[model samples]
Target: MEKIERGKALKTGRDYEDIKFRRKVFMSKCVKKAMSLFRIVTLIGISYIVLSPMISIISRAFFSESDVYNAMVYLIPQNGTLKNFKLAILRMDYWKTLGYSLLYIGSLAILQLFICSMVGYGFARFQFPFKKLLFGCVILTIVIPSYTIMLPLYMHFRNFDPLHLFGLLGIGAKNWLTTVKPVY
Candidate 1:
């Protein structure tokens, strides 16, 4: 039935094909336009949601310290300035912290994805003793909160001192940031 209409369309004077193609182009254009709008709206919404608080904070930071303190009691300040930025930079070292956070998060994501894919492939393809148990353990680890191990991890790292290894690598495990020597 569809084929017959297409056949008749082909026979007709460019009406069916032209109309069909135009309709397709129109639909495609509409879809693309809608998608573009959606992307823009989504981006704007996300930016507004994320940046509004930061903007408010930044504005407040520009006010006189006394003014800022007073404003905090009521509504936030509208003023903005370099003093707050300078003070913030001196105190927090924003760039360094941001870099560390990015590196940590990026490494964790890559490691998790790689390990999951490899382990999933192994579980899907291979048979081993207590395989289900091992998989369950992996799943459990994923679900369990990492905050639970904070103190244990802190203690482990604190206690972990490599006598010769530190000298060889020119790195003390205590401070990774100050090390000029690469870890071996």
Candidate 2:
């Protein structure tokens, strides 16, 4: 009778272990499924945010005048045409404008890249008097809206002056707006 009771006890212990194993497997599967769903949702949201504007712009570019007026036209234009591209190229004088832009803006951009790198290196490596104040000014310039300073900057450019030195030197204010000197 004791041997039979010991056999029954071992059988119940094995059943308990089997139940625990099944529960662990079920929980892991649930966790994995939840994580996958979260990832899918996040990807869809990011796709919509990034693609919506680009899709709208492409659709609008292809849209006809009648398509713009039609309320039902959305996402896809009913009458697509390359007329807009031709008009834009002709009106803007594409080649000449592109050449001028590449010459001026491209040079400035390269120069700016070098200047900024040197300035950043200086700021990162050196400690100077008024360093914090100068850094603060740089931050302020970045944070402040360009439009707020636009009028004053425009006026200053129209009559270039540096710390009243030009005035003291008896040199007349030079108009920088007419020249590419402002790029410097």
Candidate 3:
């Protein structure tokens, strides 16, 4: 029994000093491979868990009337049909809504493009006093959440509606949304 400064201590009468070292290396490699496989299995399991409900709902939507209830409950369908598609389209009023949405989106896009281009051009080209300050103020307004001003805006619209001010221009108060002929 003697203590050495550097190398591993050797036993007097055994032919297996390196056996433990070999076992440690083998175990570490196995553990690393196992962990990698475990991670891949976990990710696949999570994907299936997350997408199962969506897939089930879409499949159920195609099931026939008699099979729909069972399919929804069991997440399987023995029969399929297109009745859901017809009901969905009828409830949504697809064509009418599509036309109205297209018109609304077109007008909104044109107005936004014109206004943004004009504002951007002004900011880039103009040299009025306090221009940078005004730009900073506008940027601040954009960055700020609108919920802060929503109450104030609601109160202003309710109390000081511009439609009522049309009386000052000798126009009678009328439904502004229906007839938008300007009075100001």
Candidate 4:
């Protein structure tokens, strides 16, 4: 049967199904577009949140001493200068310090990667005595604050001695605090 609307005849069976299918397709397209937009906006917001600190630090680096002291200035500097960078390099031996820091950090990173990889492999492939306890200890170390272990570390390095050899030789305890060993 055909239906007459606005002086136009509309097919009732196959045409009706075709119309419904087109509407559904159009609605699905709109929904997909909206979801894509929402995802893009969300990711952009997260990226900004993650990058804001680095942006703030980089902007602050251009500020002069006066600009730093001024309560009115925050992000935009009135008297921008590279004086801070120059002072850090010349007066504070920044290059030497940076090189040493990079070396120390790089070594530590490599060591950590190797050690963690081995431990992960062991956990994945093998079963050992105290396996659960060891895993729990590792997790506990990750969950707990490093500050809790600071006292013990300080005490150990405050007068570092081994096998009582230093005491036997009358050399006394050697303080490792002055070295970069404890800083890591």
Which pairs clash in the backbone of model 4?
none
Please give the TM-score that candidate 4 achieves against the real structure: 0.60
Candidate 1's C-alpha runs over 4 A off are 1-64, 78-83, 86-104, 151-184
lDDT of 4: 0.89
Best by lDDT: 4
User: What local lDDT score does residue 58 receive in model 1, on the 0 to 100 scale?
Assistant: 59
How do the predictions measure up, each by TM-score?
A: 0.41, 0.57, 0.47, 0.60
Ranking by lDDT: 4, 2, 3, 1
For candidate 2, the lDDT comes to 0.88
Instruction: Count backbone overlaps in model 4.
Output: 0
lDDT of 3: 0.78
Q: State in Å the error of residue 176, model 3.
A: 10
lDDT of each: 0.76, 0.88, 0.78, 0.89
Which regions of candidate 4 are displaced past 4 Å? Answer: 1-7, 65-78, 127-184
**Candidates in descending TM-score order:** 4, 2, 3, 1
All models, RMSD in angstroms: 13.1, 7.7, 9.2, 6.7
Q: Which candidate leads in TM-score?
A: 4
Over 105-149, each residue of candidate 3 has an lDDT whose tens digit, in order, gives 999999999998999899999889999998999899899999998
Q: Give the Å error, residue 44, model 3.
A: 13
Candidate 3 has a TM-score of 0.47
TM-score of 2: 0.57
| Tens digits of lDDT, candidate 2, 1-184 | 1233444555566667776898999999999999999999999999999999999998899889999999999989999989999999999999999999899988999999999899899999999999999999989988999999888878767787778678888987777788986667
